[model samples]
Structure formats: C-alpha cells, structure tokens
Target: MKKRRVLSLVSAAVMLTGIVAGCKSKEDDKIIIGGLAPLTGNVAQYGQAVDNAVKMAIEEINEKGGILGKKIDYRSVDEKGDPTEAVNAYYSLVEEGIVALIGDVTSKPSKSVAQKAAEDNMPMITPSGSEESITKVGKNVFRTCFIDPYQGKLMADYAFKKLNAKSAAILFDTGDPYSTGIADAFDAAAKELGMTVTNKEGYASGSTDFKTQLTKIQGSKPDVLLLPVYYNDVALIAVQAKQIGITAKLLGGDGWAGVQNQLDEKNMDVLANSYFCNQYDPTSSDPDMQNFLKKYKERYKTDPIMFAVLGYDTAYILTAAIERAGSTDPDKIIEELKKTDYDGLTGKTVFNENRNPVRLAYITTFEGKKEKVLESYSVD
Candidate 1:
C-alpha cells in the first residue's frame, strides 16, 4: 500500500516541474481535482451550493487519509454562468494539472465545458447539469444528475398517473436548450399519455413579464401549468401567473430546487398547489440522508439543495474511482468510474452506457417555506 505525507513547497514545485515536462511525475503523490461553477452572477445559488458541498466532501475525505494515500488538491474556478467563461475556466484547470473535474453546474455551460474536456480525454462529471448531450460528448464524461428528457418525462408521467391531470400547459425559454428539451419531452409524453396540451408558449430567456403567456394559457384553462426553467424564472413567472389570475396547479423539473428563496410570504401563496421533480427527497428519514443534511446545515447554515447533494455525491464517486483504480492514470480512473454503483446522499447511482446515472426522481412541494417530499419514482 502507498503511504501518505504532506507535500512540502519544494516537493510541490517539483511536481509542477513534472507537469511542465512531457509527462506527470507519478513519484510525486497528490491527486489534483478541478471544479467549475457559477459562483457569482445569475445562477449563484446552484454553483455556491455545489462548491460548498464538494469542499465539505473533500475535507472529510482528507480527514480519512484520502484516496490512494494521497490527499486531494482541489482547485475551483468561477465561470459566472457563461459558456465562454466555463470553457476558459476548464482550460485554466487543465493547465494547473487536474486529473479529474467536477462541474460547470448549469446545462449550457456544462455542455460547453464537456465538449472542450472531451478533446483531452479528461474524466469529467457535472453534478447538476441535466442536458443529455453533456455526456454524449465523450466516454470520459459522466454526470450525477438525470437528463432533461428524463426529468420532463418523469413530471409528465407523474402528472398523468399520480395527479390524474387531464390537461396541461407549458411555458419555456426559447433560448435555453434546458428549458426547450424538457418542454419538448413533456409535450410528447403528455400527448402519449392521453392528456391534452392546451397551450405551449415560449418566451425569450431573461424575460421578466410572463403575463402575456399566462393570459394566453388561462384561456385554455389547463389543469396544470409546467414551467421548465430555472429558479429565477420560476419565481418571476409564478408572481406574474398569479397576477393574471392563472389558477392552474404548477409543476416543474429539478431546476425549481432553490425557488423558495426567491419568494416571500406575500407571493408564497402562488406555489400553494405546486410540486416539482427533484434529485433527492429532502425530508428523507434514512440515516445517511439525515446525517448528510445535518452536516450540510451545520457547515453552510442552510438546508442542502439538490445541487449540493449531487456535488457531494460526485466528489465521493470520483475519489472512490481513484481509490479503486489505485492509479492516477486517467484511463484507469475512467474505467473504474464506469462501474460505479454507489448509494449516495441523493440515491443509488449507477452509470449507464451514456454515463447518465440511474436514480430516483423525487416529487417535492413547498410547505410554508419548507420542502416536503411527497413521492419518489424511477424511470428507465
């Protein structure tokens, strides 16, 4: 077995010298991992949560002697939710000699980073990027979250089978692949399930007013309204929907995870009869789940969101692969990652051929600013 030691400044400089050479020095033992996320700007909540949880996981792993007897050196860059910035951040991390990557949290930037990472065959995993094309870029790429199509179809099936809804309406962002992907899947699934789609409206991304769409949807009087967008858009649309007297029950995908923070007591009524698909059950009674939640709350002083839990899972999954391989070779780590079957804070995660995890979808609703998990379902 290999031994562990803290690398001195001189030893670290030598490792960097090896990186500057043609090949990395295996004799210098320390695993370098890179993280990319929008730590500021639009989707800061998602990125901050992921970054915090990943750091927490790394701290715990280091405390336990780390993988392969080498402590992880984590380097993170903020992409600020921009695709170009995310690609730039990816290159920066690669220059710093990262063996593996976790991030580019949202869908668009994740796809951008994944495409670039594929060129170098870097083992990359996005914790909360639901875009299906993210892992399709390369075999070395994987994700801890389910794809957008899966989430859309899951919500559609839930609406039809569980809620027994006869009709539905959709509001999506035209510029966002994430929103449109889910909307398209939901439309097809709802139609296939014999539910009527009264109105399917698309608006430009970053639009503040949704009354035009909501008023149009009101004319159809659908039983449910689907908003397959991020938390900011969800908050805006919910307020606007209420203003237009749209009384349809609200439904959404995992992107709705942090929407509660965007609402106050006055507007909370808009989400009274609403539910959304999530990555995990926040109210789980399971011991592992409770322990994670407790630690996360103590560390961040806030309840862990789906992205946070996914980030925590990704760190463990990546390090576990490194430990199992017992080598820093990217190929060995990638192969070990392909066989992952770890039950994490979120749920059982087994990677499929596409490198998408097979996990349960949780249906959650807000109850007086607290999230209540109502049901859990799995889709093939």
Candidate 2:
C-alpha cells in the first residue's frame, strides 16, 4: 500500500509539469508585440501617454477579433529614458517572442534599440523619436514623425516670414544628436531666410545653469531664441530666460512633448507666445482626428498630448502592416510597413526609402497652457 501511494505521488508530479508546459506553449502561441517607454522619469508623461494609447489600440483591435484571428499580446516595458535600460527592455520583450516593436519615444534611446532591432531583424516603429539617423539604422525600422531638417527649416521660415523676426539665437545640447541636428538645420534656414544668427551656443545635457548662455543671447539681442531642448530643460530655460530679461520668442522641437504638464500656473506665462514643432495638432478639426480625440478622452477622461496621438497611430500603423502581411513574421511585416501610406489621425503617413514618414509638422504655440495651432508644413 505504501509503495502504491509513492507511485501515485510521482504520477501527480509528472502531470503538473505537463500542465505548466502546456500553459507556456499557449502563451507562446499568441502573437506578441513589444513597446518601450520611459515611464518613470521627468518626461514620464510622454511615455505614459504612449503606453496607455497603444494599450487602448490593442484592446480595440482585440475586441474586433484580433489580428489574423489570433489574440494579440503586448509586452510593454519602461526604460526610464535611459538608452542602456531601453536595450535591456528590448531583450526582455524579445524573450516573450514579440513579432514587432514600438517605442523608445525619445531619440537617443530609440536609436539604441533600433540598432538592436536591426541586428535581430525585428520590425520597429518609433512613435516620437525625431532624430534623422533613427530610420537609417535599417529597413526594418520606421517612424511616424518627420525628421529634424524639415522641422527646423519650418520653424526658421515661420519666424522669419510669419513672425517677421529679423534675427535668432540658438541654444542647444551639444551631447544630444536631436538638438544639434535641429540647430544646424535652423542655422542654415535662418541664413537662407536672410535672418542673422546673432548667437549659437551648446550646453551639455543635464546642465542646470543656462543663465550664462541666456546672458550671451541677451547680449546678442535676437528676435527669437531657438531653444531646441527637451521639456524639463525647457521649463528651466524658459524661467531663466525671463529672469535674465531675455524676451525673445522661444522655439523647440517635439522634445517639448509634454511641457504643459511641467509648468505651474505661474510658469505658464513665461512660455506665452513661444512656439514648438509637433507631430500632430491635438485640437485638429479633421473628422478622423476628432473621432480619435473623442474616443481617447472617453477612455482617459482627459485630452491627450501629442505623444498619445503618435502612440495610437504607431499601433494603428503596425496593426495595418500585420494585416497587410497576413503573418506575424518580422520580415513580412517590415515589407508591408514600407509600402504603407495610411490615413492617420496625425496625417497621411507615407514612409520614404529610409522608412521615415513624410508627414506634416504642426507649428504649435502655447497661450498659458492652452495649445493653439499656428499652421502646418509639409516636406517635399
């Protein structure tokens, strides 16, 4: 009887192992997509928006009978806006057998993960990373926003022609590729527009003191200050610029993704009359855009910033590629993504040979936490 009991126990143990293996296989069977975001830092608002917006898209798609008749699984992780951390998040998601990736919202980390995705032959689409070099990593990589040259030139032209600015000063981060690239393009455009660049200076990333540079720009007394920096830095710079009595109009790129969240009521006045380049007009009246905004607000109980629009579009775009490819294979998805010209909430997004989307850059201005759309520009 004792021997019989021992044998039964051994049989039960074997059955348990089989059950665990079966569950693993079931999870592995589902098609997985990965997302990377900086969900815990100063710019966490952008990442959080991307994360939530994509998850909402995934849910909507699933409810309508997920892609290819299989329920889609998402493995999204936060990298805290660090490049190395972003790579680590990528590998973790890769282990879950993801067929494609979306994320690394900022340029530096997105560029890092894009290189890794290239090596792995993974299809990637960055919702917000605007660095020009990102798409050049590989054909497997794509983006939903225009690059710096177009954005910079557009800003310069707007200042010179729209705002009637005769001179500009640029202060950017030398260590940041995005900052430098936009600054270079702006400088060239300023020259072409016959606007003098009275001052151009570079400060390393994470530098707290911009008063020195602001003083120099104040001395130059330009009509506009091209502050091609991130939102956190911009908040500080904006305050300092006002303190130093530099009243030049401020401008920036998409790195100022969630500046409104960073500013207090007192600080909002400082950013008044400033403009920034953005991927989408959050208050657009286009029917499609209006629908998206309505649905997004219904889900989140608030209007979304630009990153949320991008995140939703990126997911929407990827799902389109998945349907077009009719498979979860990365190679097939990349092929389909390249041929895509989807009517997105942001704009009609068409990927170029470099897999970068040729889309409109909305010149957005702030009126004390209220975003006003100035105009939109398209690159040829």
Candidate 3:
C-alpha cells in the first residue's frame, strides 16, 4: 500500500508538469508585444500618455477578436527615463517571448534600446522618438513622428513665409541631441530662406536661468526666437524672455506640445502668441480624429496629448502590419510595416527609406492654456 501511494504521487506530479508545459506552449503561441516607457520620472507625463494610449489600442483590438485570430499578450516595463534601464527592459521583454516591441518613448532611451534591438533584428517602433539618429541605428527601428530636422525646417519656412519674420534667433540645449539637431536645421533653413539668424546661443541641460541667453538674444532683436527645447525648458525660457521684455515671437518643435499644462495662471501669459510644430492638432475637425478624441476622453477622462495620439497610432500601425503579414513572426511583420500607408489620427504616415515617417506637421498655438490648430504644412 505504501508503494502504491508513492506511485500515485509520482503520477500526479507528472500530470502537473504536463499542464504547466501546455500552458507555456499556449502563452508562446499568442502574439506578444512589449512596451518600454519612462513611467515614473520627470517625463512621466509623456510616458503615461503613451502607455495609456497603447493599452487602449490593444484593448480595442482584442475586443475585435485580436490580431491573427488570437488575443495579443501585451507586456510593458518602466525604464524610468534611463538609457541603461531601457536596454535592460528590452532584454526582459525579449525573454518573455515578445514577437514585436513598441516604445522607449524619449529619444536617448529609444536610441539605446534600438541599438540592442538591431543586434537581435527585433522589429521595434518608437511612437515619439524624433531624433534623426534613432532610426538610423538599424533597419529594424521605425518611428511614427517626423524627425528633428524636418520640424526645424518646417518651422523655418513657416516663419519666413507665413509669420513674415526676417530675423530669427535660436537658443537650444547643446547637451541634448533633440535640441541641437533642430537648432542646426533651423539655422541652415533660416539662412536659405534669407532670414537672418541672430545670436545663436547654447546652454547646458537643467539650467533654470536663461536670462543670460535671453539678454544676448534681446540685443540682436530677432523677429522670432526659435526654442527647440523640451516643454519644461520652453516654459522657463518663455518666462525669462517675457521678464527681460523680449518681444520675439516664440517658435518650437514637437517638444513644446504640452507646455501649456506646465505653466501656472500667471506664467501662462508668457506663451501668448507662441507657435510650435506638432504631431497632431488637438482641435482637429477630421472625423477620424474626432472619433479618437471621443474614445480617448471616455477612457482617460481627459483630452489626449500629442504623445497619446502617436502611441495609439503606433499600436494600430504595428497591429495592421501583423494582420497583413498573417503571422506574428518578427521578420514578416517588419516587411509589412515597411509598406505601411496608414491614415491614422496623427496623419497619413509611410516609412521613408530611413524608416522615419513621411508626414506633415501641424502648426499649433495656445490661447490661455487651450491648444488651437492654426494650420498644417507639407514638404514643399
């Protein structure tokens, strides 16, 4: 009887192992997508927006029977805006059997993950990493937003033709690739358009005081001051410029998208009459965009930011590629993604040879913390 009991226990253990193996096999069969975000950091707002949007898109797709007739298993990691942490997150995702990846929302972390992903030939797409070199890291890397150079040139042309500005000054963070890349392109395009670039100045990152730079730019008396920096820096610069009594029209890239939220009631006055090129116009009248806004508001109880729109679009784009490929194989998905011609909430996006999106820019401005879409510009 003791021997019989031992044999029965051994049989149960074998059965349990079989069940676990079967479950693992089933999990492996599902299409898995991993996301990396800076979920807790100074840029947490951007990361949170993207994370919410991506999950929303995945939920919507799953409700419709998911991609390739199986439900998608979405996993995400918080890298906390650190480059080294981002790479570690990618490895964790890869180990979890993810067939595709979406994220590392900011430029530097995105680049770090892309470098590692490229070595593995993993298909990865960044929703809002606009640095020119991010996609240049590997063919496997792609983005849904226009690059820094594109935004810079677009604003330069707009300033010259629409704003009728004859002179512009640039103040950027020399330590930041996003800021410096746009500054260089704007400088070149401004010169090409016969707009004088006056008093180009650079500062170290995390500097709270820009009065020194503003004073020099004030002396130049530029018709426009191009600040191709992030929203926080833009806010500080705008406040300082206003205090210094500089009247140059403020212009920025997509980095300035959420500056309105970063300012207080009194400081909001500083952004008056400022314009920035962005991914999408929050006030767009397009039926698709309106529908997305409605759904997003219903889900998040707030208006979607530019990063949210990009994240939603990236999810749709990636899923569409998986559907077109008829498989979750990374190589197959990458091939289909290359042929993407998605008319998303952001805009019609197609990957250029460099794997960057060929899309137009929305010239957006603020009116007392409300974002208004002024116009859209294509490469002409």
Candidate 4:
C-alpha cells in the first residue's frame, strides 16, 4: 500500500509539470502588434499598400527570428478613413494588450489615433501621416514621413526659384488639417520669397465641383495655381480647371503623389507642368534604396510607392527600438526612438523633439514616361 501511494504521487507530479510546460510554451509563442488603416474607403489603396508592406516586414522578421525570440502577431483594424473610427480602433488595440501599433494612414485619422495613443502612453508610429501637428501631440507618437509644412515649403521654394513663378493662387481643403497646414505654410513661404499671392480659395472635403472656385482663380490670372489637397479633390479640380480653360501652371504638395493615377490621361495633359514634394524617389541610386527596391519588388511583385517605403522603414525603426530597449516598455521605446539616427531606406532618420522625422524632401514632376526628380532639400 505504501509503495502504491508513492508511485501515484510521482505520476501526479509529472502530469502537473507537463501541464505547466505546455502553458509556458503557448505564452512564449505569442507577441501581438496592432495596425490601423483605411482598408475599405477612398484612401483604401494606400492603406492596403502600407498594410501589405508591414505584413511582409513582420513575415521577414519572423523568418529570421522575431524580436526577443517570439514571433510577431499583428491585428489590423480598418479605420475606414474616419476620425472616430480611428480612435475606436486604437482603443480596441490597446485593450487587446498590443505591444505596438502602426498606422491610421491619412492625416486626420492619424491625428485622432495619435492623440489617444499619447494619452494611453502607447508606442505608435504612423506610416504616412504628414500634418505638422501629428508629432506635436506627444512623445509617444512617431512618424516615418516628413510633415506637410516642409513639403509645402519645398514646392513653394521650387516654384519661386526653379519655375520662376511670380504670382500664385492657393486652393486648399478646409476640412483637412493636412491641406490647410500645407496651404498656410506655402502662402507664408511664397510671400517671404517675394511671390505675390493673387487669391486664396477654400473648398469642403469630398466636393466634386470646383468651377466657381476655378472661375474666381482664373479671374485672378496668377502665374501658378497651388492645390494642396488629396488625390480625389485634385483629380476633380484638375479636370474642372481644364474645363474652365484656366491655363496657369499647377503645383501641389505631397498629397498629390498618386493624383496622376486618378486623373484621366487626357486631363493629365492639362497638368503637364504639375509638380509635388515627396520623401523618396524610387529612381534614386542610393545603395540602401536600391536594395530596398529589389527586395520590395521581389516580395510584392511590383514597384513600391513612397508610402510602401515609408511603411517598411517605420517597421524597421520600431523593431530597432524594441531591440534597443530590450523590452516592450513604452517610455523606454520612446527614448530609443529619440536616439534613432539609423540609416533607413528613405534616408537617415532622426527625430526632433516633437517626434517628427528630420529628413530630406524630393521635388518630383511627371515627364512623358516617368516622374523626374527636379531637386532635393533637407530640413535643418
């Protein structure tokens, strides 16, 4: 009877040990990251591109060996390009115990998410949000791209110095902080550069008809027309400007990156002199950029846009911070990010006090068969 009791106790101990080991294995295998982007709305294409790049990065990181020996698990929520939806997505991700977050792609949604994440002290990085105010919210929010003010100044300076435009008119979207910020900065810079501003006009978001605005602008007869708005509005405005026979040279901020794709080929002819600011030129011969281009093409089976590169770099920076911090503490990660002077695919990324990237901006124009890089500028 004594021998049987001892054997029974030993068997129970072994079973308990196995159970604990299984639980430990499960815990060791899980690492959750959060993503928020507009997966089904007007900006869905860009959002989807960022999401794809992030997923690819996570896959590659896992293949080699994930951060701290655990595979990365990501949960992505579609913000649908709405501010409230973006806030809710952040809240949900935070509640789910995510270690980090990427996105809220556009400016407005990103701003909303950044504010909430700051309040919650979460480590969040935006792939393409460009409003100047985004990084000003707090130390917790970091952006992979330059702000709209730099982009606006880039175009304004280029217009005055390179294009030799003496006077210009501004057409901006009132509902978008991104557009408004760029327009404000461009107007200021143009005046400082001795360019006369003939007229300034504003339109609501999602407005298709700009004939009235264009009519007023045409009457001003400025040397250039600046449209610091997104692709949808840009397309409509370009088409309407052509319809109204306004022949002034058109210029735009970084928001114009994919506008040509949305415009009809015939309408694009009207914008032959159009130019915009961007962060990266895929045609760059920089060795880092070349390798990124090759790897991105190999993975996605296509060329990457500025946003894709931004998304990829954002992931790499955040992962590097994690590695440097040696833990998932938000405060520690923010400190590491502040110290980031790492060479990324875009360029050398360093953060200002506001957590915005101090980087170079490229001025690009559409030529017959390609987008030509006109110039590049770095912010001090």
Candidate 5:
C-alpha cells in the first residue's frame, strides 16, 4: 500500500502537486480528511461535540493501523455557525485535496459545503445536519443522521400512535429551514394521522420573549407542544412555558439533543416529562453504544450528545468506505459508502439514493436532571 507522511511545514502541498501535473489525484500516498463545524457562537455546543467526537474516532482509527496501512490526517475548522464562514472553510479544505469531508454540523453550513461538493464532485458527509435538502445538493453528499422530514413524521406518528395525543401545537422559527421544515412536516403528518394541530406559531430565533406566541398556544390547550429548534431556544421556551402555567407535554427533534448541558435543573424542570428525537441512546444496552458512551464520558468529563455520536459515526463511515474501496478516490469512496450498513453508536446506517441514512431514531427524556433513553422507533 502507498504510504506518505504529512510534513508540518506544508502538509497539503502534496495534494496540489497532482493538480500541477494535470490529472486528478486518484489515490495519494497518504490519506487526508477535513471537517467543518461552528465551534464558537450560540450553536457552539453542537459543533464542539461533533469536533471532539470526530477527533476521537480519528484517534482510534489511527491506533488500529489505519486504512490500507496509512494513518489518516485530519484538519477541522470552526465555521462559527455561519454560512459564509463555512463556505470559506470548505474552499481551504478542498484546496488540500482531502479524500473525504465530515462537517458543517448545522443545516445551513452543511448545505453550503454540500453545494460546493456537488459542483466539484468532492465527497462530503454531514454528522448532524438534518435539513432534507442537504443531500439534494449533490450525489457526493451524505449524512449520518435522519433528516427533518423523516424525523418530523416519526415524532408525529409517535405522538399519535404511541402517546395517543389528540391535539398538538407547534412553536418554530420560520427563518430557519431546520425548524420550519420539521414544523411543516409535522403539521402534514398530523393531518394524515388524523390528529388535530390546534395551533402553530412562528418566531425568530433572536426573540427572547415568546409570550405572544405562547399565549396563543396556551389557549389552544393542546395535548403536546412541538419544539423543533435548537437547545438554546428550547431552554428559553421551556422556562417561558412553565412561567405561563403551560403543562402540555413537550416534544422536539434532535435539535434538543443537549438540553441538560446548557440549562440548569430548575430551568429544565418544565421538560420533566418531555421527549425529543436523538441520534444515539446513551442509556442503550447495545454493547457498541455502551462502550462509546463510557469512553465519551471519561474523555469529555460529561455525556455525549447526539451531534457527538453522529460525528463519530461519520468518521467511521468514511474510514469504512476507504477500506472497502481500498483507495482514497472520491468516486470509489462514494460507491462503497452507498453500501454502508455498519452498526454505529447511533444505530445501523444504510444510505439511500439521496445519501441520507435510513435508521432508527432514539427518544430521550429527562428524569431529575438526568437524560435517559425513553425508546427508539423507525420511520418505516
């Protein structure tokens, strides 16, 4: 097998060598991978979790003698949860001739990179981006987590069939494709499932007070309140909901993955019996997941969120693809990635035509400030 070492002075210079030679680099002597995430800003939790987990996966893979006898070189950038910054990061990585990419943890930034990968035919995979349109950008794009459409419908079905919730209310951010997509999908699914959508309200993420919207939903007296946004918004709403005496069961998507890490016990008390879709069940009995959970807690001094598990799975999937293809060629990796069926901490992942994984999603609920696995369900 070909083997090369990255020079500290100009690690990515070798990738540009092939371009100067006029042919695409089929497989280099060394393997390189790139990642993008918003490591700072309000959404930093998701990005930091993904970054740490991806790094952990890379370390484990390297220790095992890496794919085809060459250790993998990885470089990740902080997108700061901004689309413009994410695109800039993508170009820098692309110039380095990375074999594959895992990144842009959020939907918007993920979309930015996926678009470039489509135009350039570069292989890219997102760890936690749930916007359904992400994969639509390019055939080379993929994701480790379920999409918003499926997740929305999955939760809607859960509310109707499992919880027997007759009426639902939704509070989402219209400006965000992630939030609106889920709200739209849930509304549609609720109607199809014969469940009543008592009230649906939209708000901007910057708005601190939700009294205007919450007041309307409170009057509806819905059995459940769907919060398909990130943890920051979810926490604020949780506090507001309780202050307003709203006792409805709260439901959310993977965006609610790391609630406890952000909010205190009293701030999260409103969601005592609430639940949200997650990428991995930290409390699952699955041996692989158990091992991951244990190691993650030990390494991070805390729990692993869904983004972290998805990021780890993204690294595993890329390495598995490289192993199956036996080369760093993007085309070969894409071909092998489509056949992926590896059991990960998240679950068994199989990529469909759109490059989205078809897998089960776990639901997490809190018990006395402790997040616990409620159950897992399939979209099928």
Candidate 6:
C-alpha cells in the first residue's frame, strides 16, 4: 500500500510539471505586433508602402533572431482612411495582445490612433503622418517624419533665398490638417521674411475643378505660387493653371514629393521650375542611406520613397526601444524611446520631448524623370 501511494504521488507530480511546461511554451510563442494602415482608400498607395516597409523590417529582424528570442508576428488591419475606423482598429489590435503599434498613414487617422494609444499608454510610431499635432499627444506617440511647420519653413526660406521669389500666392487644401498646417506656417514665414503673399486661396479636398481658384491666383500675378496640397490635387491644379496661362514659378511642400509620377511629360513641363521639401534623397552621400537603398531594392525590386525610408526607420526605432527596455513593458519602452538618438536613412534623429524627429528637411525639384536635391536646411 505504501509503494502504491508513492507511485500515485509521483504520477501526479509528473502531470503537473507537464501542464506547467505547456503553459510556458504557449507564453514563449506569443510576441505579436500590430500595424494600422489604410490598405483601401484614397491614400492607399502611401499606406501600402508603409506596410510593406514595416513587413520588410520585421522579416529582416526575424532572419537574424527576433527580440527576446521570440519570433515577431504582425497583423495589419485596413483602416479604410476613416478616423473612427482607425480608433476601432487600435482597440482590436490591443485586444489581440499587440504590445506595439505602427500605423494610420494620414494625419487624421494617426490623430485618432494616437489619442487612444496615448490614453492606454501604448507605444506607437507613425510612418508618414507629418501633422504637428500627432507627437503633441503624449510620450506614447512618435513619428518618423518631420512636421508640417518644419517643411513649410524650409520651403518658405528656399523660395525667398534660393528661388529669388519675393511675392507668392498660397493655394491650399483646407480639408487636410497637413495642408492647413503647412499653409499657416508658410504664410507666417513669408510675412516674416518680407515676402509678399499676394493671395491665399483654399480648395475643398477631392475637387478636381480648380480653374476658378487658379484663375483668381493668376489674377494676383504673384512671382511664385506655393501649393500646400497633395500630388493628385497638385497635378490637377497644375494642369488647370497651365490651361489658364498662369506661368508663375510653382513651389510646394512635401505633399508634392511624388507629383511628377502623377503627371505626364507635358504636365510636368508646366510645373518645370517647381520645388518641394523631402525627407530622404537617394542621391545622398550617407553610406547608411546607400546601403538601405541597396537592401530595399534587393527586397522590393524597386527603390524606396521618402515614405518607405521613414517607415523602415520607424520600425528600427521601435525595435531599438524594445531592445533597450529588455522587456515589452509599455512604460519602459516609452522611456527608452525618449532617449533614442540614432542615425536613420534621412539623417541623425533625436526625438524631442513630444517624440517628433529633430532633423533637417531636404529641398528637391522635379527635374524631368527624377528629383534633384537643391539644399537641406535644419529646423531651428
């Protein structure tokens, strides 16, 4: 009877040990991240680029070894370019046990996600949302791209000094926070520099008919026209302005970064002297940038845009924070991120108190088939 009792106790101990081992295995296998992007909607191209870049970064990290010896898994949900949907997406990812978030490309969606993430104390980094308000939310929110004020000031200075344009007209999209922020900054800077902003015109987002607005701008006959709008709108406005015989020198913010691709040869010629600010330049002498281009091309079969580079850098920043924290604790990661001063593809990045990148904005112009870097100016 004594022997039988001892045998039963040993068997029970073995079963308990197996159960604990199973639970440990399950815990060790779970290290998932969340990506929020607009995979379907107006800004889908940019969102998809960001998503692809993040996925590439994850795959490269996993190939070496994942963080804390656990494989990193990511889930991307389509926000559909809606702010409310973006909020829902954030909650869903949090419910799914995602410790970090990368997402919501535009300013509106990023704003929505950032607000909720800040409230929950979740660590998040935006890839391409350049509105100034994003980082101002809290320490939990970060961005790889510089804000509109930086780009606006850079462009305003460039127009006055380099382009020799004293008087300019402002054409902006009021519906976009990004555009409005840039427009406001540009107007203030132009006024400070003694440059005359002859007229300021606002257009509704998604409006292709800008002839009337362009006609008004043309009437002003300013030396330059500063367009703080996106590529699609810029292209439409450029074509209409040309039709109405407005030959003023065109200038733009980073929203016009890829405008050439959206225009034909004839349309591009119409905006021949146009220049815009950009975050990354492939022609840069930075060895890190060169290596990034090589690796990105090898993986994606195409060169990366400023957005893609920003997305990749955003992932690296998050990974570095996680590695520095040595755990997935949200507060610990946020603390580590505040101390980050790493060199990214664009340049050396140091996050301010608001978690926005402190870096220079590069000025580039559409020179026929490519963009030419004119200059780079740092933010004061």
List TM-score per model, in order.
Answer: 0.89, 0.85, 0.90, 0.84, 0.88, 0.87
Number of the candidate with higher TM-score, 2 or 5: 5
- Estimate every model's Cα lDDT from 0 to 1: 0.89, 0.86, 0.89, 0.82, 0.85, 0.82
Residue pairs with backbone atoms closer than 3 Å in model 1 (clashes): none
Model 1 misplaced stretches (Cα beyond 4 Å): 1-27
- Per residue, candidate 2 scores C-alpha lDDT tens digits across 1-380 of 99958955764564456445534654745678889999997679789989989998898899998888887887688778888778877876776677899888988899999999999999999998888989898889999877877778888988987889999999999987878988999999999889999999999998989999999999989999998877888999998999999999998887786787788898788888699978888778898788878888898887787889889999989998998899888889999999898888888888888888888788888876878878886545
lDDT per residue as tens, model 5, 1-380: 12423331243463345245423443566688989999998789889999999999999999999887888888888878888778866777776668789987998889988898888888889998888999998889999988888878989999888889999999999888888889999999999999899999999768889988898999999999999998888989988998888988999998887777678755757779698988777777788888888899999997777788889999999899989998878899889988899888878889888888988888888987777887888766
The clash numbers for all candidates, in the given order, read 0, 0, 0, 0, 0, 0
Order of candidates by lDDT, top first?
A: 3, 1, 2, 5, 6, 4
The best candidate by TM-score is 3
Judged by lDDT against the true structure, how good is candidate 2? 0.86
Best by lDDT: 3
Off by over 4 Å in 4: 1-26, 285-303
Which of candidates 2 and 3 reaches a greater lDDT? 3
Model 4 agreement with the true structure over 212-307: per-residue lDDT tens digits:
999999998999999998777888898899899898889987767777778666766766778877777777888878887788789778777778
Between candidates 1 and 4, the TM-score winner: 1
lDDT of 6 at 292: 76
On the 0 to 100 scale, the lDDT of residue 55 in model 6 is 88
Ranked candidates (TM-score, high to low): 3, 1, 5, 6, 2, 4
Residue-level lDDT of model 3, residues 155-254, one tens digit each, is 9999999999999999999999989999999999999999999989999999999999999999999999999998989989999999999999999999
Model 6 collision count: 0
